[model samples]
Target: MTARETPESIVVVLGTRPEIIKFAPVIRECLARDVPFTLVHTGQHYSRELDRVFFEQLDLPAPDVHLDVGSDSHGRQTAAMLEGIEDVLVDVEPDVVLVQGDTNSTLAGALAAAKLNVDVGHVEAGLRSFDREMPEETNRVVVDHVAEYLFTPTEETRLYLEREGVAGQVVVTGNTVVDAVYQYADVAAEKSTVLDDLELSPGEFCLLTAHRAENVDHPDRFRSLLAGVAQFADLTGHEVVYPIHPRAQSRLDEFGVDVPDEIRVIDPLDFLDFLRLESTAALAFTDSGGVQEECCILGTPCVTLRYTTERPETVYVGANCLAGLDPADVVAAGSLMLGKQPDWTIPFGDGRAAERILDALTEVETDTDTAAATVTPTETTATETLQ
Candidate 1:
């Protein structure tokens, strides 16, 4: 009934590669501290490159449970995840369910845990694009309201929660992505040969990724984006390398959208390989929230392909610009961003978020246990005196 009631166990649920990357530090901290926790994979991103390869590359333990809920319509995917996650919650009966980021898995994990009367901990919580048209915004809002612990990534986000009157206990733990980037940047540089393999020189090739449902599901927008990439390449004379998402590839075939010769289309890369490419890129053009944050930390200028973004810090700091879905606009934004200096400060954490999160969870449990122990004798004494 109170924040002091400690959870006996924790279940960490994730579905996509970004979630895996962001949560990897938390998972590692749990293992290192000998915390009682289990990893559950909802299989939101099912491809080997997108999913399993990250575990191998990151040296993370394989998930104890995999829901295998692959791609589908938003409603159907959420429903499948809810059903599968509900089953796991019932069996495990964890005192707390931990979910990161705004995804279907985050929403489902929170909803199921709340329904089961289990405590919910939402990492990277209180993010808002203020556009209900985007499913991620809706997921974030819902999860924040239900979570017992809101581990927000920034002070701005904590204020967002306060303004919303969120009942959850909010803590500004900073974004764990910062931790992931600091931990892996050097590893990627030492281990990855992506630049050599792709025959790319540092800061000479533009890296691109666009696979948001809003962009790929609409034919005109998708075509316009492709045309814009072509125009950008033509204007800058820099090769545009796109590691296509499976969804985008399907849409390309379905809509008969042609990729330009200057744009090299390739399969997705593992986390290390992609980080190596991203860190060395001339500029990144993407519709991914994760990429926007990655570029900001890596000091690379970025052109966001979406109309709006939840991560406004990157834009405010002048490390990123929103280019929407127009070809001419995308080219212009890319050209403008290329000339800007990468002299922005990192707005995220100090790369110690995981340790802080583990400390917070441990403190909560200890306080809860101490409170329970103190209350039992008081109630017992009162009862004995009355008798």
Candidate 2:
């Protein structure tokens, strides 16, 4: 096989805490196997409190390159990341670039690598909310189409790719969040004292998170969501523990929105502490895609704060219900979910997703080597005969 034809190195690019948590196992696998790779951080989630704490808690190595392209309007942020990532890719000359989920960082990484003629592997690809209004939906669609390898998390996602006629090789590797949850949940339980600190008990409180622009940026929507959560807490007599994101907090102040006293808004938590809270919560109210998957995996009933969800498997399996922004709908959904038994089967995976993903990547390398070797000898023989 020609050395040039086979992948020799991989560049893993990510930006947020969720990306770090999901990719931690992949980075560890590369280190353990002595795989030649470089980690690149886009700094989309640039806050030290939000981003740096994840790396520390997850035990990930410092990124080889940091773009430091902090918050901006979506177009500007993505454009900045695209420029920065292309520079890094040119310098690294990696054989393949890997990105996870549907963030601006993920789309930028895929777009840069494709433009540079490098193979791009997209983890958590083929998800579709079909709502173009959501920036994440747009990012996932664009990245999936450009990626050379689509590592889907489920059969449904694989089918989504097939129906879309994606040119990439699609593989069902299960969700890496399953791996993260299984790996870190116990650690969180052992290390986190958030329950005691908050004066809450497990299975008695609701965990709430709303950071998406659609949910928190609009003053009316934000107020309605908070009011609904407050109502739910009052009705259930359960505390709603909300770990506020920096942007969300700023928007609240900028818009003159007030948090209901019933909803306890705390500072954002470390990954471990968040995981502990997620696993033990009686119910979860969220707009984040990752939280939906986490709730399903942890058997925690969830009321999705969005009108549409990409993870429909959660709803089909009776784990999540869509409540949108209507306060009455949110409370009703929460009430219904609260009474439901936690007996739904988890559709994500058995938590060996990281191992499977690494194996799939290695297999691609091997297959490329075999195909290159076969083609080289035949071409060489034909040239000799002609000569």
Model 1, position 22, has a per-residue lDDT of 97
User: Scored by CA lDDT, what does every candidate get?
Assistant: 0.85, 0.85
Reference-based TM-score, model 2 = 0.92
Off by over 4 Å in 1: 1-7, 364-387
Report the CA-based lDDT of candidate 1 relative to the real structure: 0.85
* TM-score of every candidate: 0.92, 0.92
**Model 2 Cα lDDT, one tens digit per residue, 1-387:** 112333578999999888998898888877877778989999998785568778888888888888889899999999999999999889889989999999999999999999999989998888999999999999999999998878777778878998999998876777888778777877898899988998889999999999999989899999999999999999999999999998899999999998999999999999999988988899999999999988887778999999999999889889899999899999999999995666676677656666656666774332422322221121221112211
